[model samples]
Target: AFILGFALKDILANFFSGLVLLIDTPFSFGDVVALSDGSRAVIKKIGLRVTTMYLIDSHSEIYIPNANFQGENIINLSRPTSHYYYTISIPIKGDVDPARAISLMEKVVLAHPDTMGELEGKLEAIDNYYGHSGSGVKQKLKREVGRMRLLAEQDVTRMLLKIEMSLKQLSEF
Candidate 1:
């Protein structure tokens, strides 16, 4: 019985931590959050066992265990209303419900050529990753491509940051 209790210690701790997370509501779905690992992604889903983060830059989803949250700090990038006013300016169909609107937006964004290309690159890299069946030249090219994509993403993110700063300045004035 003592052994069983010890064996279940971490699991119970994590489960309870998950409950605390739910109660606290520190972050919500679609809010971009940063983890201890320096990984920043949009919070997609918060489950009892795990929190899902969707990385738009890489077009990938990362599942983080709730226990990790208890051990580390999380930064919510979507907090405070006056500074960052993010809104979707798209027009929705008259008959579309909230769920349908969300689904449509997701589908439309994911279907964009640039998004699709990035997504494919991400998929290819993940699939071949360290387990490449091709020659060194092909592998080198693949990695180079991935690097280029990351650099491009970083540039875009930086540009967006600059734009936001400018907007903030304008709003202040």
Candidate 2:
């Protein structure tokens, strides 16, 4: 009995932790999270006793015990929206015009296909700069904007449906 208890203690703890995580759902599969160890990873799967994650920097899979995962300080980068703020610092010559440099940098970043910025302004800026260079940045930005809009509309529709169902139940009572 002592041997069995010793062997099953961790397993039972992990199993219960997994159950709590599944119910509370702080993060889900495919969500990006920053671990307490300062590593960023994407959650691949949640299992009975462990969670599988793909580390972004190492490009490798890591399995963490549910109990440990539950105890750690994990930042869910994908929650409240999948958008996270990033910052960069650049050094420029003192002789350069600061305003011009800042403007140029902003335009360059806004012109990137993957960046999130005002759609119309980005399209106009891309058109002015690329001017049919055949880089396809404008088209890609349009497609991405369309996809985001579609996802937002779907979420609104889902919420409306839930509200309608709740109202129906209230009326029945």
Candidate 3:
């Protein structure tokens, strides 16, 4: 009787906690959250016994006990803004100046007209680079791109490339 009571206590706690989480809205569907284990994932669903999440790094779904949040911090990356941001990395030659690279990137991004004007697309260097070892390349740009702009730019780029090829063929003929 005593063991059953203790087991039921944990289950009841989880059930109630799940209800509170659903109502409180600490996170929602598709909202990305960082778990205490350092796993960043998107909320897939919330159930009575567990909260389901799809881990970004592992590409797997995990069930976190409803009562699990009590022990760790949950960083909600999407709660602040509905617009999701993605990183676009640009690799420059080792000898190229960082400032000039940034300026050229700005021009290329601004020319697209889809970067959402005056957005000041952020540029920051990342540590990972795969150039020749002796070159000492210290600059790589990471820019935040909106979902819509990313898709649109991809389509536009493909179309422009096709057009360029057609123009070249016409000139040759």
lDDT of 1 by residue, 1-173 (tens): 99999998878877877666765668765567777778789987777778888986788998877888866887887554445544668776788798977754555443322232355444444434422323466765555654554455555446556766776799998
lDDT string for model 3 (1-173, tens) is 99999889989989978866765668766568999888899988878779999999999999988998777799987655436555788778999999998866655554332233332231111112212133433412222223343444445446556766776799999
Over 4 Å off, model 2 = 81-173
Which 10-residue window of candidate 3 scores lowest in summed lDDT? 122-131
Candidate with the greatest lDDT versus the true structure? 2
Cα RMSD (angstroms) for every candidate in the order listed: 18.8, 9.5, 17.3
Please give the lDDT score at residue 29 for candidate 2.
66
> Which one wins by TM-score: 1 or 2?
2
Q: Which is the leading candidate under TM-score?
A: 2
lDDT of 2 at 8: 98
User: Where does model 3 exceed 4 Å of error?
Assistant: 81-173
How would you encode candidate 2's per-residue C-alpha lDDT over 31-132 as one tens digit per residue? 689999999999888787999999999999999999997679999876644356677988899999999988877776665444556556666555454323
Model 2: what TM-score? 0.49
